[model samples]
Target: MAGGGGALEIPERQKRGKIVRRKKKKRIGFRIDLTPLVDITFLLLTFFMFTTTMLKPQIMEMRIPPEMYAKVEVRASELLTLMLTPENKLYWYKGIADQNNPPQEISISKLRALAIEKNLEPTVKNRLITVLKISPEANYARVVEILDELNQAEIPITEAITKEVDEKGEPVKRQRKFTIAPLTEEDLKLLQGEGK
Candidate 1:
């Protein structure tokens, strides 16, 4: 209630009128422009592509074993040969293929003892050679039993073997020599059929 000058300041809200009420209602479409986001993503991808260290670990080339091929050679002197027959009989022979008579026709217990003794040998401590003679009449059960007995003894043996068998099932004499069979008749027939 002073002199009425054109300055009317009743309340702070009344001073700001229609201009404040209808300021900018459309909100400028709230653009958030995904183009910049895309550009940033591409920039990050490019940065990673150019600056990242794609480390490739080095590898050594190894000579892999092939099927039907032996890995190592077994020496005669270092081996304790065991001959297993088709009748579940086992024979023990050592060094230069001598007459294997002492531990002949051995059962599981005898076989185990022989294997343990050979394994315990000072020279053949690591190398216990057991040659299993499998005849055509031999059952797989016997083979498994022999293997299980060997496993029970905890003595490792090799299948790398030299076979010697007589046609008459007689003992191989000192004059007798060991030779590997070249091929089976079935294999020959298959080859012949292929050729035809």
Candidate 2:
């Protein structure tokens, strides 16, 4: 008998029946750390920054005189005048720009050859001065091409003729002497009269 109640009866189970219970294991939550991944990413970025090489810009070198207004007298025979028209036409003449020695139309392709031939002449060598006058309406690219052609024209020099020597102690190559000036009204008339 139970002390708090009347006598308690226990129920009997059949010999073939039984009950079973199993304990469940506690599950742990999944977590991911980003410290190592961040470190690796920074390491790769720094490696690329330190190993990459920067490219240099290509440019042409030009030297300007100290005095811009200073007038330098040059002989008429040593002067070579070049004019560019709005029609992309190029004209050149030796000495002064006049009707007698009128501007002859020349293609830009032949400019280098003509410049070299004139500069190598016995009378004009080392003394020839090139004057380029470009019209405001002329193509800028044509102007640059003309300048590049002139720059590429070089005159060979002998050690005995000139004392100038390059950094390598070799005879220096003489570049074409050139100057830029504004195209005047007279020059335009010359081109128009020539039927160009």
Candidate 3:
């Protein structure tokens, strides 16, 4: 607000026996409205809240083997089975499990090196079928790690139920194409060990 003069009056001065009107002084005051400021602040906050990106869970990419591809037979001699436990223990075996070639216990840290070695092996270079027999209680990260290693080695991923042999003492059914099989108690004892 502005004013022409203050409420208090000044004393008159005698000048040449004639009364003269004095010029009024300018006065100033200020008032601020905070409602608009508060409204704008809230609008900015709401805009950021709606426009900002929130964190999302990450999912691992997987390559699922085709159904027709699954129909192709895989030989036991060309198969490599890896058993993963919840304790991070890895048991791997090449070919059919027998007294001559038994499952060897290893650590997860050795998988990358093993993949590199297998990639160079003639038996596993191209005809190899790796079956991941993961336990139900195993951590999901363990499976992802194995899959990543396989990817690094340029190995194909698969999932299928396999058969060992027939009544004729011959491998009538095999790990049909390239696939990952769940580790059942029977499969664990057969592929890993009885103590597993």
Candidate whose TM-score is highest = 2
Query: Per-residue lDDT for 1-196 in model 3, tens only?
Result: 1342553332222332234455545667788999999999999999999998898877766667656335666677777788887566788888887777778887767776775565446454445677888888888887888877766555321211113345787643322234676778876666545354
TM-score of every model?
0.41, 0.61, 0.53
Error of 1 at 113 (Å): 1.5
Model 1 ranges off by over 4 Å: 1-66, 69-72, 99-103, 155-196
Top candidate, metric lDDT: 2
Order of candidates by TM-score, top first?
2, 3, 1
What lDDT does each candidate get?
0.52, 0.78, 0.65
Off by over 4 Å in 2: 1-57, 155-176
Clashes of each: 0, 0, 3
Minimum summed lDDT over a 10-residue window in model 1 is located at 173-182
